[model samples]
Target chain A: MAPTLGKRKRITRDELEQPSRPPSPSSASSESESDSEDVQDIFRRAFEAKFKPLEVDSKKPRVEEVNLELEDQEEEDSDWSGITSDEEEQVQVVEYSHLRHTGDRASKAEQRAFMSSKPPTLSGSTLFKTRPSTKAPADENDLTEASHLKNDVALQRLLRDSHLLSSTSTSGTSTPTLSAVGSQRHKSTDLHLLSLGAKSSIHAQKNMPMSHRIGISAKAKEREERRRAEAKENGVILEKERRAKKFTKERERGVGGPGVGKFRGGTLSLSKKDVRDITSSGGGRGGKGKGKRGRR
Target chain B: MTDETTQTLLKFTGHRHLPSRLLLSTLTGRPIRISQIRPNNVSRQGLQPHEVSFIRLLDSITNGSKIEFGMSGSTLVYRPGLITGSAEGLGASGGVLRHELGRGCEGRGVSWWIIPLCILSSFSKGHMNVIFHGEGCVTGAHPVSGDLSVDSVRTAILPLYKQFGIERDIELRVLKRSCAPSGGKSAGGEVQIVFNHQVRLPKTLHLLNPGRVKRIRGVAYAIGVGGSNNARSIESARGVLNKFVPDTYIFSDVSGAPFIQTPNDKNNPSGKKKGAVGFGLSLVAESSTGCLYSADVASPPEGGTTPEDVGRQCAYQLLEVIQQGGCVSRSAAETVFCLMAMGSEDVGRIAMGRDVIASENTIQLGRDLREFGGAGWGFRDKGEGSEEVVVSVVGRGVGNVGRKAV
Candidate 1:
């Protein structure tokens, strides 16, 4: 345990101090060369234990740190691996062409072959260094295995490329109009979603009609205007109107049913008539209406 | 008898009572013979009740005399006997005898008979007959000489007593003498006379009694002049009687004016030179007489010259006599006396005395008696024949005594 503890400390220090190295398989090949089966078994065990509940608690911090370091190395490796794969494909094509051309210059072709070959070797070396010995070949195979992994790789590349392209383009424009359009489009989509949700919620309730709800406000405004006019003409006081509204609302609640309709109809009609009569008669109808409303 | 004597006989014809006849004869100093040809009988027509009582009053003076006379023509005619005659015979003879006596004396030298008879009737009846003698004969011995005395006066007597011989006893007595003081030169005497004897006549001779005769005599002496005094003196004497006399009846001469002094101005030398000396004497005599008869008998206040007080004193005395049952008729007498007492040489005395008499005259005797006597006792003036005889008799008696004292 103490030796492992000293080794973990040395790794943390090395990780912090090192920049990055190129991928190579040689160092990692030694383990597979000597005990390929054992290395495979160990890889499976570490993978399982990393997921185990009991070990998860204990290994979460290390694993998270190693995963962050691995993710960095993988990013670098992927760049280099992409370049090498391209070179290798070019070299193979060249070699095949040269064979087909018997009259070509030998030295120029060899020079071309040496340049393309150098990229694969360098990439392969980087890949071998980061991967375990059992995964070294697989890493090379991963380069060659496009048909099987092409969609993921291409999708990832597409996402990254798009993200990068957008970021780059946005940064490049730095103009207020383009950003405003983008923000407007985002806000409109959010508002569309919110309205759709509210519509559904209201539809679920089903008690209030759209027209009634809308008209209630319009009617309130109309009644308010009428009341103000009546108050102006016959001194139909605002205090009386407020009291009538409150009483009607309370009466609707008191009946414990859909009596709001009846109450609204009665109060609205009576208050309208009262206002009309009071206005026309110059305040005479207040006495009669007040008496009737009081009794009710 | 000669016609003069025969006429004198007629004077005795009408006498109805003996005492009245005797008194008449005495006062006149004449022979008065009375006869009764018929028996005496009381006649309703002979005299009034008061007159009959008056005629009987002389009986008190004469002691007693039973005489009956018939009343003829309101005069008493002597009857034939000294007893009351029958009313039938008095009626038959009274008118003829009264006519015969009046007619027989009317024509002849015996006209003096009518004077005495008239005087007698005047006395008994409370009326009088008076004749004015001339201004009195002043004696030579009078210190101040002028027409100071009255010379002659007519005498009045009752006709029924003309035949009876009785003399009036007028004797002068010096009750007091007020001569001038020694070394002062004046000779004046105030003398008083008393009639002392009573005369008697049969009741058949005259209709009047003796008391009535005395009263009549007293009244006559009060008014008549005795010795000699002027008309002023006689008037003063009458004033004394008028103030004091109680039963006296007064009759004045028809020609005599009530004696009033003439108002003289002292500053006028002519009036002083023509002065009347007897004026002051008469006035003093009147004042002295007024004091003697004053009811209070106290001297009046010195220098207190309210003549009304003096007159009131006189009136009070007269009222006393009347209260004692006397009568007086001094209405005419007082009017005359006040007129004379107011006369003088001094204008002040005359004016003062006139004012006093005027005030005194306003005091009526009848009204005063009515007030004094109270109710039933008051004397009413009964005209001629109705007055009580005792009132006249006592009035004359007191009046005579008061005058003599003065």
Candidate 2:
């Protein structure tokens, strides 16, 4: 039990030391190696800040009182062992592919995602760690076995290779697109457009469609909408098209404004049809200035 | 009232119960004289915009109704018309036909004027298809004030009016909504109502136990301001109301151009400087028994009133009204109670009617209105210690004098 305990602690320590997989397994080996240095520092500092204190206070023996005895620990170990291997491999794939996504530098930034979930990886590693004897053979087999499987997938390999090739081909490739995506994510809301008397959502409203479907339905609709908005601004009362656009936008928003109309008292730009509807219904009477009919 | 006391009752101290007295006089064919209107005031004269507009409204509704004001404008003499609407004017649906009929309401007038007009329409000679135009009117008095007031009137008055068999034809349709004190002639409020199917009387609004306020419906309105004003007011109103009724909703009615216009902007057709931007809230609560109680509050254009303040203030006003514990909301209590004072006066009729319910506000208002109108009934309470009083009046049972004696 003591031997296994020492081995387990060593494994947990090793995992704490290294979160990024060996750079060799990833397509961007050199970049991962360079990025790993900073990432490892982050992971180490995080574990020291968050986990070491717990181990000192909890001291595995007291932890057993909470039913996490050796056998339970072994079970927990087995549990984490099974999943962490897979997580490490999948995370490698994701990191490598994304490295391919925004170019060389941003891969370093994601390496900074250690900032986001620094504590998260600490728990994942501690949840399962095996002796070096078991870990080496198993880790190698798991690494090679699963690593080959990613190669067998044409799409992932293509994406990973493409991102690598793109970055190597152009040193100036990623910063702009990456910042744009960042800005899009942080834009808070789009309610500053000065809509009067609109029943807008009080929540963080999502106006743009974030879907990645083939048709880019929202994008096309937006383009169509821009043109119509431009036309409307030019005082073009395209009633048929305006209604359609209003309905579509309203549908997307899950909130609707009082329909298009002149602000009898509100600031609405009414269509001729609305005006006609009122006049047709016998409303245009006595509207020619105030009447003094019954008054002296 | 006999000939002698009527003169004493004709005079009132201030203009508080002016509408009530005017309505009561018109209902019973009683002539009334009032004095000292805003006598102790400065800056503004005897009749504020709403009062003068109301007087003009009364003149339009009743033919030959004579309203004489003293040169100082502190005193008034009112001789009501001998009823003149005919039931034949009510279309097949017991509503006024699609005819062009309405009066004008001025800038200082609020949409609340519809209450008395609704009451009058119910009992007028012909189906009074009167239209009203006002400063807030887009086309006419089309209720652009962004309020739940008209619906509140319907809910509160329907039960009271149901007793008189004048139930079906009470239609109040908003044709246009115009925000007041802005948009000049371009924006105005307009409304048309159909009533007086046969001058059927209302049942006594006796003890219609005000059921628990099931839910509240409201409107948060802002004029010449950004849309956020309505939202902020609604949020703040909900903050206080969350204490008493969790089930409340105040829809926003933010109007005017999204951009503030400078006075000299060419788009400013009215040429008049836009008045201070305004924010207001109107709320109506419907009870379990379908009775409605309502309250309205507005921000003084330059009072530095915040959205939260308007909302909290409106909520407090509503709470004060609901606490009065009567069938009629505090705002409409006087109007309902005055009609109750002139209802079918048979003892059995009174007994069968909703128990003569009156609250502190209603009792006070009824007393003032009746005193000034020089007509009233003997009021009884369920013993002295209790504040609740049951009002009883042998109704004048006014009929249509225009019916050719048929």
Candidate 3:
């Protein structure tokens, strides 16, 4: 197949070289005698039927002229025959059986692994040295691992916020899947924060007027009382209500104030509790046993 | 505690395998009395300077160790002490122990002390960080005494400790490189070893299979010599090793000669003189199973060989070590066996070449362990017509006494 391809390429090259040959005398001779040319064309057609077709101006006349010129040259050139046969020389095939490195060249990571102060491990210099291999299989593995992590995070988020989805659906939101919209998104975030041990809701107001706070508490208490009374009348069991603990506020004292009472404008004032404590014989805790102290 | 004072000291004669004997005594907390140390040598009898230096090093690391030497220095008694390592106020400053080897210790390489010290460091109570420096520290392989180069110890021996669960923070840093001194010259090499991993008991090792060698890595170091020596050695070594293992790479390290103070010299009392200078090659062949085989060669002290010869000799030596067919090389066998014996009370097995097992040092070590009250080794031929032998050693269960309660 290769030999035939080479021969066809040579024929094409000959066609290209034809115009550069100064319109050789062979073409002129063929035009002068139409009878002989017709005979030659008929023979060529028969030969083309049996085998490969021949060129119109074959290289025989040019080669004869070149041979005559070579024969007239010096005798020293007689021993040398130019243009040997076109058969390709037998390729001197040299096969090496020794193991050869066919992969990428040694990288910097491998150099570091081997040249570091630490002893080079078996897999360090050879197999897994290249930390950023980025090959097909390794890249595929990394992609799958990353996707798995992403999916895991998504699953955890879904489970944690499933109740929010149900509550939003009952409220008649249009897009009621795992995704929350607008206010529902804020509610979802609040719930997530609360689950993560937030002390108070983000929506809780930090400061308000005293009357407004009192009115709000009173209204909430009245609503609870009404619900409980209605539940009792209807003979329906209801969960126990939780009461918020109340904190007592003590009076603030300055750093240099009297121990028992406040000092107001260069005057020291004491309360009845402070006087009873001062009259007692023992210290603060011992003052509880006032009768024993009096007997003593 | 009272009975420890009344315990009889194990008695032995001659100075053969003195380092191993001392190491075992320290590990097992047994006192030993060795007599007749080169008693017949009229010129230089008794313990050599290096031996005395080793004893001094031991004394500095340990506390309350009682040592007694006879008038002639031929008879000696060493009562073992707790392995304290480089504790504060015990010949250590700032957590590092500095030991200076004098000029008399130039006959033996520094590895002669380091290898044994490493074995003891594993069982020490605290971290062992030691810097060995001075005129006698030869970091290269000893051409006459056959001690391994510091590179081989760091690359080959230290890696084996990982199998025993003692791999953390372990490093051997060669601060200055110097070859063995020729004639009366001195070597001013500096080396530091940081072994911060101390274990109550080294994990039992059961290594049997020595897999095929897959790659060869090496370091060709030239000190106070032309850099072309490194290239020449790497070329010749590769010429030999590339035929078998095509994955071979050798790194070249070039450094200038070290300078040390010549204090006692009358001509230049305050001046500094250059130390030994030469080139060397250390080759390590790692097997598929993480086993390592190493070979070391350096320029001889008399200095008549070419770098090519040194490289070719080292490559062939590495091939011979690989052909020995074991999970550990002969140079590291002592450390492996000692750690095995000092492990937990369980049987640990290792496959070694027959020649390695039959070596005199191995036989002497077996004897020394028995004398130190450790269990004897059990040996059997590795099956399937292999020349390797499987050796089984049982631990004494008496690991680091300082860490026993912990």
Candidate 4:
């Protein structure tokens, strides 16, 4: 026991001097290494002053001390062994992901309701839950819900385009395309656009030549007039003759144009009608001016 | 109108519970004469600044109210008028009555005036939209005066109006935040109350269920301090409250101190100074049946307490309030009881905890209600070995004579 005690004392003395002896040799061997170490020491001290004292200094020294202790133990006690390289290589992973459930905190809607200037209502706790729940469990319920939604959409579309179907049926085509293919599809789309507050039908020819459009409108009027005449001769009560809607054309002007006149190739041109319209005051106007105003 | 003048004045003494007495007087349409208010205190006698500010507010909101004070300011005779809330040409501009508290009113919180005004707004003839701003408007909790923060008043007390059917278009907006100032200082906070719902009579409430606490919500605020203070308080509060209730969430609010315009002096004519700076915690526990319990704590004006202290104190206070086990907490009991007493001519039963019922303020409110010709309250045990009691109050048939014709 006395020899063991002496050996332990000697070993601790050696350990105390061991760190000092190694650093002195390294500093003597390389000046730049010593200088860099001094710089690192300064930074560590400054960091410690601002925030927390660092444990890196103590940890590195303790690791080396532990290695020395293990070496001493290996020489003294042959049966005991320290941690092996395999143990050091193995890593353990700890996870706390499951601890954070979504329900632990207030939802965004709840926050808005409570933090608002208005007094929180009694239903604030269950207000978010009262929203329309689209989530349904069970495969059977899912299938039925899907089919119901599909059928509802189909019925809505059919009801919207049912007038088109009726018009086709009157033309002796009993099978009015419920599938909405070809011409029927265009008619259905036109009806949908009208119901959504579209200004014109989808079949209306845009960017047509002036002569073609005029001829088409004239033919349509001639046909209507012929049918009206036939109905009158037969003494059958016919509907009133529908009139075509007139579109007013306002000429687009350049930003640098004269305010009340047309600009073409750096020239301001004002028609006599335009001048007369500008000069006319409230209800004091002649027949020609009035007719022109009414047309506008 | 002539009969109102001929009615005898209800006589009362002392300045204790003066605000509630004034509220009852306004509500009941009875004149009151209070004498011997702090006559013993020679240096500081008569009404305090906050109390005077409250009286001024009541005077502004009411129409035809006649007020007279004695030479020493110890005696006051008040003839309350109809509650014409924020009417034009009555100290209100642009439909908002702006009541300004002076520098002397730094001790008490702004909620001290707001809570009572809310009760008056319910029975007002017009929509009540008042903006309270001034040097002494402390939106945070008062450590010395025992007044709640404005957050608790909004989240806890104002929610009770729904039970009485006076819940429409009501809002309490905290425009500026300030904590209680130190001695002789000011807190330039701003708060607004918009109570537009006016009814002939509030619905009779029968709330007997003190349900289990489903979740806890809170607001941690820091004014003129670091944002880290709010985080600190929130962490500490959650530390204590999380063990009991798993669904606790505390929101953080940080704002700079409000600047108050001071009188011109020789050195700096454009006098401007920052108001009080502090942090506070306000916790509100909501139950399954819509019952609310609240607790408030703010750092002392002298500034020794930490944010952790305020948070822990608030958390413990909330736990104690919940442990009392009632439909309404102590801070909100006065509003709940007064509104119940002024409700429709029907019996409204509420379950209150034992300690809340036995509080001094509750007892004083009961006596004051009786003095104003309101009915007395009847108490009964809730169940066998339970700490709760069911209080039945019969409301006066005469509710809001201003609104009676409508």
Candidate 5:
């Protein structure tokens, strides 16, 4: 009876450890019987996980938490897709692990494909739709916000760390790996805050458009005004000179009439007397004149 | 004015050979041989009338040879009737007969008489009449007078003057007569002829006073020598006349010798010889009427004047007379140089023989005159031993008039 019991337990731990090795004909018959039982267990768990979607949702899947739990177990048998050929072989390997791994292999594969494809596709659509709007606000705010955000050292440090992590992870993987994913999350959060700040600064830029345009327009207007003012001053001076010349010519023409006659006559007499006195003095207006009169 | 009237008178007192040789040579154009006869050493032997006539013929012939009036044709001859028993011929006749008896007398007496007479009479009128006076002689009569054969001499000269167109105003007067005997044996008598004419002054002294007239005439007389033989003599004579008498017209012979004196020696010391008298006749042609007169007494000498001086003074008076007659105008004074021959050989050689030696002597005298300011007026020999000197006469005013004594 013990020999029969040994024959029924054909899926051994060694075979599971080296999955690539082929079984003997006697062991192959017993391993097939055990593979059927393991397959029934994977199908039942896949159905259970599928029906408990609300539970999964309630649990809030921590990708980091899941990756950490799988780290040690996956280290030895990390190649899961490689064990798909023998379900009993994979069941035997998993039985040795402590984590509750209930999903059927086929169902788990489908879930990974679905999860990976959906999140990236959705995220790409989100990036495409927000880029133009976001860029416009940022550029608008940059002039004002760059001055105001001069003291925001936290945001600056976050952007600098993200940039460094992206640079390091980009060098190791084609797609951003687990490490780059964290940096991507941080970059997204920084972008969201920058968008908020950009919107507020954009409002501030819009408020002062009239004052800036007015400053430029004011300079051109001032130059034109100065030119007009100078022309007006010149016109006034020329008009004054013309009036003076006309007065002088009228006096010389001896057309003194009305009030002008007496005024001009008196001025003329005074000027003539001055000229006569100068001439009679013989260019020595004081001493010589006195001497001549005294001698006479 | 015929050639017969133009006579050339030359006097050689002490010398005879040279004159005779010259005369013979001039006449024949050939040389002649003759014995020399000195006037101071003459003999007293008388000559025959015919012989005297022969000698007179010889004298006429010889004298005619010296007559160079520049007249045409040969000399003329004359024959006068002989003198019968005239005392004037006695001396000459006795002298010739004595010479004939002493020397060779191969020719018959008649032939001797006829030949000499014919030859003498042939040249008689043209003969130069030369008169000589010894130391003391009478005033008129002379033994040489008969020997002179005056008719023969006149005959020779008259034709000569007519041929030469020489005027007949020339007069020959006997002022004194004398001669010296041949052989130096007898005292010779003298005969003087006064030859005179109105020497018309050059037309340069028509307005001078009587005193100035005398001075100008004196200058004119001095210029008369050497007038004929050389043209320079006549020119100088005219020059002299022009100086002192600016308006007196001069009428001169072709020879230009004054009728009073020989052409040469008119100013020499020997010119002062006594019995060698000269007189003048004035012939004034006014309105085509010629007036002839003896002008000797018209102007007397100023004081203590000798005959030579008187003659010169009279010559100046004649010049005044001519000027007064209106023959010359006053403008001729400017062209004259008076005293032109005062030291010139033209004046000195006028009466000299035409010999080589005498010509040389005359050339020397001319050079001396040139050395003393040429031949201007008033030149004089200071004395016998002194050199000849010039006496300047400064003329006043324009035209060389009013000459002041300087």
Candidate 6:
């Protein structure tokens, strides 16, 4: 599908005002000269179909784009129901022309059916009543992406809270705080907060491509920083730790100042002269030469 | 967790080898009852501090476990529970949320504790990242707390695990090394481990011949002592092992000791802070056919087991392990034997040379494996003397269903 920036279907003022008017399957299939105004009507309807979702809502300020998109679709389907045969063909031709660029028209239909069949609720519902194919995280990620579009104020606050919580947990033990959050999350059935290992099916994410649905590697850029930060965590078993900033420092910290043990185990007090004696005389660590083979 | 009513209790006489019994019981999901736990002795009848510590450790990683005592701490009852996946699942949401191992304080007998735990890892669902806190980890061979260190586990038992099919992403890392008898100094030398688990059973450990020893590597550790002490021990060990293996190198490490304040200087036993100092050494021998045999020796509490003696003893112990003619070492033989017999239904073999018979502990372990099902299995000495004896078995294919599908 073309990106949202390219190829928008413009709406005439008529469809914008009368979006609820239903289309007929049996529109007048008569001679064209008498019904010239109908050609203009078709363009108005086509324009409304193309760009109505992108229009700003002057009405209720808080309705989510997802719902607006769903509401727009419901209106279009209702309009199509009343259109006559030849007019229906014209209206559908326009719909198909616009939809072919935006992939998966069937998903749009499915979503319309979903929104209509089940009433959207303000509060989260259990998994049993959720749309047959859409798993919970998909909905969450969709909301997250929508908010991500332009400095999602809500998402930023949530991210800040999550960031603080993660930093505190990593710095030390914050079991009580985590338990409290867990309790709060339990009270509200936020799917991400719950440790439910439900196997995700495809329908819930049909709107998203496989890449966006997985949300794994595409997030690698953000994940790289996390990996670096986490490399400081307990420890990773590596054959050779690259001299990255993470591995340069010591892991097992020392006792407080002048406390008990030395900084790292202990050190040999070898005078400069004694050091020369060991190294210059060909003795010390990582010995290179062959051992003096005693005549057996 | 399992139902108590479904259990047919396996009974034992005393507290001897209780860890093995408890591990086997946990693995098999069987309830156990031991009536005469030193019932004859009466005074020292109840479980020791370490044994009780082991039980607490087991409880930490499991769900719905129950334990009861009867007959004045002599008779005991324990019902097995499910192996809860990870104590801290994913640690947090995203930073490093691969899998959870678990967190527990392995008080004593950790050497024995790790064997059963690693065996469990083989049958678990995902990767496990376990962290152990508290003391008694870095010490030498103690009767209560077993000696095997993280270093020993990495060099010795891990190879055997590889032979058994868990070949990737296995680690035994010592984040902090501590000696035994840490008297409230700090978190007694922390260690973290990451173990990978798969669905399939472990493959056979068919190390038929170890060939001849080619090279030797060792570590000489001196806590709160000068590096000279470590160097002294390394030089001494070389004197003995050099005759057989020319490529012998012992790296010397000198770590500062934890300070212990006593009523007077005389009462201080370890001499770590009060000046006597601590020293120990471990050696590993590599043969031509890529088999490893290892041994370790440590200083005693009385400031005995001098550096020279430590190096010499460690080297000699390695010699003993190599002379046994099998690919496995004496210290690790018991662990290797148990994994082979307990793994899925497949024939596993280990070459045992007459230079050393299986230790009494290994023999007891063989008997214990039999009790937990693994039928038609025993220690078979195939050779009288010269060639290595091969002990083979077909396991019961006992896979742990405790780990759920993640």
The prediction achieving the highest lDDT against the true structure is 4
Model 2 chain B is weakest, by summed lDDT over 10 consecutive residues, at B347-356
Per-prediction fnat: 0.00, 0.00, 0.36, 0.69, 0.00, 0.00
DockQ (model 5, Cα): 0.00
In model 4, the clashing pairs are none
Off by over 4 Å in 4: A1-110, A123-296
Lowest summed lDDT across 10 adjacent residues in model 2 chain A is found at A115-124
Residues A1-296, model 5: lDDT tens digits: 01122121223433333333223243324556456546644655676687542222122225424533454355456433222234322232224554222221223333232222111111112322455553564665697787668657555655545665667566885554433346455565556566658444322334457778798668867876676678788874323222224443333333443321234544633345454654677665567445553112
Name the regions of candidate 1 deviating beyond 4 angstroms: A1-296, B2-23, B26-131, B137-306, B326-406
lDDT of 4 at B171: 97
User: What's the true lDDT of residue B324 in model 1?
Assistant: 29
Q: Rate the local accuracy (lDDT) of all candidates.
A: 0.28, 0.52, 0.82, 0.84, 0.29, 0.57
Residues A1-296, candidate 2: write the lDDT tens digits.
Answer: 01222223323433332353332232223444556556765765776687442222212333323422443466666644222222221221223332111121223333332212111121112222464573455667798988788767645434434544445347664543322233332231222221323365344345645565425766878888998899889987765754344443323322355543534566677577775655654554554435422111
Write one digit per residue (lDDT tens) for candidate 4, span A108-145: 88888888998888647666467766875659878998
Answer with 2 or 6, whichever has the higher lDDT: 6
Clashing pairs in 3: none
| Model 4 Cα lDDT, one tens digit per residue, B266-297 | 66577987888999999999998999999999
lDDT of 5: 0.29
Q: Which parts of model 6 are misplaced by more than 4 Å?
A: A1-296, B1-4, B40-43, B89-109, B139-146, B182-187, B259-277, B354-357, B378-387, B403-406
In terms of TM-score, how similar is model 2 to the real structure?
Answer: 0.48
Error of 3 at A214 (Å): 5.2
lDDT of 2 at A96: 38
> Which CAPRI level is candidate 4?
acceptable
Scored against the true structure, residue B133 in model 4 reaches a CA lDDT of 90
User: What's model 4's lDDT at B83?
Assistant: 97
Candidate achieving the largest DockQ = 4
